[model samples]
Target: MDDPIMKHNVPDTEWFDRSSLRRMLRTYSLVYIKPDVGRKGNGIIRVKRLRAEEFEISYKQTTSLRSRDKVYSAIKELLNPDKEYIIQQGIDLATYRHRPFDVRVVLQKPLGKWRTTLMCAKLAPRRSSVVTNVSKGAKDYNLYRLLKGTDQRLNRSEIIRNLIDVSKQIAQILGSHFPLKILGLDMGIDKRGNIWFIEANTKPDCQGLKKIDRRLYRKYLRAKKIMRNG
Candidate 1:
């Protein structure tokens, strides 16, 4: 049972501190800094390392820069060079309502095989945050409601089915590539409806099931018959 989330740390990290991070950004042109133990979208910073005479810093939708000495001071105050943190390449996120949003696809293996049960679109609040997690002030828009728009072109059932299919594809890839199951996937769909996996969760939240889609519980009743009928 290899962990899917752990697999993202492949080929070893070259740099891990603000100094190293800043240097890496200078060498590579861009990088993303995320908290290793952060949850609910806290302490995530996106920085662009540059070769400018006065280097710049950016995080959580705000961009700024200080002198080299000041940059080191900020890093010393903000990051733990010895602790776990990640500096990843940035992705061009897709937009929803003029702001960025991400999809949370819930998956489960009732009897033995994986199945997608629910999908949610978490939209970031206007001018408030970079993440769309509810704790970050993002709204939980009903996938069911979005499926009802005639002008949207995608039919209700088709939309749901596509969501499920895309989720399954991701799960299968992770299982084969990383071998972790029961993942809560944060995915982004560009304006063209292309799916991009942002990250995977080992512990997927079931509260959304309890609060939003209780009827999905009944699907488990058939779990007993999954192997027998298959």
Candidate 2:
């Protein structure tokens, strides 16, 4: 999945290793270390290189500032030896009202072809939370309205269009490799307006979309029906 999206300039990501960690941190300055099999942003840690030898690791509600080696040892202790982890270059995501947020693009292939159905923004409840997962106390906002009045380099329409195009591309590429019905794409927009792919879920949670806008949910249902009947 990462390879296919890399051509689209998705942020650099690599399997978690001590060497990769040091290299990525040195290059990106900030990175996210996440469990290979996890959800709702649980067990995800954000690591930042503050200086040549100083680092910071943040998880849940707490952040530990320590030397690079100590930070690595602390993180190593928290990991389950049997489970795998990944290191991803962190994007300085755009914020809405001082809280970081990411766009969720929902694509459904109830019919033969994939179609974009819903787009919304998930905002972190606090600045310290590393993820915008609704289960992590984040709130959903109307994608358009959320971008309204923001000082982003890209206008609202441009951002929406780019997201749709990228989502379609990802779905098409992934569909060729796997049997997929629906996709939930988490996307982040940098301050410079560049969009990056965060992750993709085959079974996406539509609860946020339903709660944020019933109209879109109804439309999604209607589209599903049309696809089924066709």
The list of candidate 2 runs beyond 4 A from truth reads 1-6, 151-153, 227-230
Q: What is the lDDT of residue 162 in candidate 2?
A: 86
Reference-based TM-score of each model:
0.65, 0.93
Give the Cα error of residue 110 in candidate 1, in Å.
1.7
Off by over 4 Å in 1: 1-30, 48-63, 66-76, 80-82, 144-166, 173-181, 209-230
In order, the Cα lDDT scores of the candidates are 0.60, 0.84
Instruction: State the lDDT of candidate 2 residue by residue for 100-206, as single tens digits.
Output: 88998888887678888888999889877778999989998988888984545557888888889888888888898999878999999887777888989887888
